[model samples]
Target: MRSKVGLVDLVTRYIIRQKGKKIRPLLVLLSSKLAGGINERSYRGAVLVELLHTATLIHDDVVDNADKRRGLWSINKVFKNKVAVLMGDYLLSRGLMIAVDGKDFDFLGVITNAVKRMSEGELLQIQKTRKLDIDEETYFKVISDKTASLIETCCTIGAMASTQNPELIEALRKYGHSLGMSFQIRDDILDYEGTSSITGKPVGGDIREKKITLPLIYSLNKVSKKEIDSIKKLIKSKNDSVAVKEIISFVKKQNGIEYAYNISRKFAEDAKNALTVFTDSQTKLALESLVDFVTERKN
Candidate 1:
């Protein structure tokens, strides 16, 4: 659905055709079942999460000047940047309208906080990217806000919509947060380890973008001061294709990949541990399997 005035509807429809993994909505549904049972409210919450997620992807493509999304032309690439931005705004407003119409004020509050945290995280990353001064603590904070907050919202909203138990909601929130963290760390690792065909982007793309991800961060901490300085110079410089490749190699040689994997595994375990309060059921096992999928996914 789009404006009656122009090509917005067609473009929006095109975007909808390029569907993603729908992981967040799946989480909402699964969490609903885990907490209590699915209902109309659960479906509404899933729709809201998907809408906001799609909006964010539109906006992210514009900001990153991305040409491809999910192996297809990005909205900005096909519709132009201004149209993409307006479409993102349209989707965001539509999501807000759904919450308002449903009178789900509590859900609205959770989503609003997620949006705020995501914005703050993006800005903070941009600021740190200038200096490349990201430490371990800052890294966790950035991922928690930017990547985990919405996942947390999905699980929390799903449980809240279906169940009256505050404890169940809290448990799902923690589960989602830990799973999201592990998910993102795996994504970062893929940037260094996966091929273009597998990841839908060139390996070392993040390094070229000067993104100081967990692997690079862990490697930097382990190397000698001179080695660190050299690596920093390469990152701070133009970061051409060769330099990015070298940086990737250095990270691998320093065992950065292994270090990051270990950390990601720990978070995945924590995610599984969060579900212990629930009784054994197929829905619970599905949630547990999702943890394995997140940590083991190639893309």
Candidate 2:
């Protein structure tokens, strides 16, 4: 118990200062209370979601070779990639211990399954990186796994822990799924539409990494075959600043950003609709507000 407490402290000391919205943990708690009630077990599940989310950010910084996160030096920038990865693993282990020790077996299943899906999603994206022909259908599946799975897990576990009703659980899960998709699309759009000064990241970072996000994917679908070949060749050059700039401009002309934003709004609306079965409550209102927050977030 002492070791566990010490480990938790170490993890918290590293992450507690990080600036994030903590939306996932909020979802866990909100959904739980909306479904029926909140208890010690529900708070445990929310904490586990937060730990898992922080672990993912650590690992993602290592993989993306990102130096800055939330406008500050990331763990990888300060301690090197090895330390960052180990810290991520430590956080995951701590979350697991918390769940199992609390005897929240069902929550354990929710999170472990989400971790599995998240790993597979990352692998899938890595596998397709630099592949110019990645289609729209495949893009959705990857984002769904990488982003939506955990969001869904947060809501589902919250519902299950608070309510035994299968229907309510299912409704909240759908709400989460739609919200998660909207959230990812918004992030992808920010990579293109937002400034580094605002978003706290470099412009064209996704393009530099050869990530086929929504705007690029839409531009590819709308552009000519000749343009496609030109863009593909430039991306393969491995140092195609000129090409990256051109792609961003072309995406704007093609209304790719607008299209992606529309899609995000649609999902946000769908998320709100998913909660129609629930009677009005503060928790339900908070969930609806979360949908508005997703579309409005700048970073």
**TM-score, each model?**
0.98, 0.94
User: Which regions of candidate 2 are displaced past 4 Å?
Assistant: 1-12, 237-240
Question: Per-residue lDDT for 1-299 in model 2, tens only?
Answer: 12455644654576677879888888999999999999888898998999899999999999989988787788888878887898888888988999999998988887998999999989989889846667789889899999999999999989988988999999999999999999999999998888888887878888888888988888888878998888777666665778778878888999999999999999999999999999998889999998998888997
Best by lDDT: 1
Model 1 alpha-carbon miss at residue 31, Å: 0.5
* CA error at residue 20 for candidate 1, angstroms: 0.6
Taken over the whole model, the C-alpha lDDT of each candidate is 0.92, 0.88
RMSD of each: 1.1, 2.0
Query: Model 2 RMSD to the real structure?
Result: 2.0
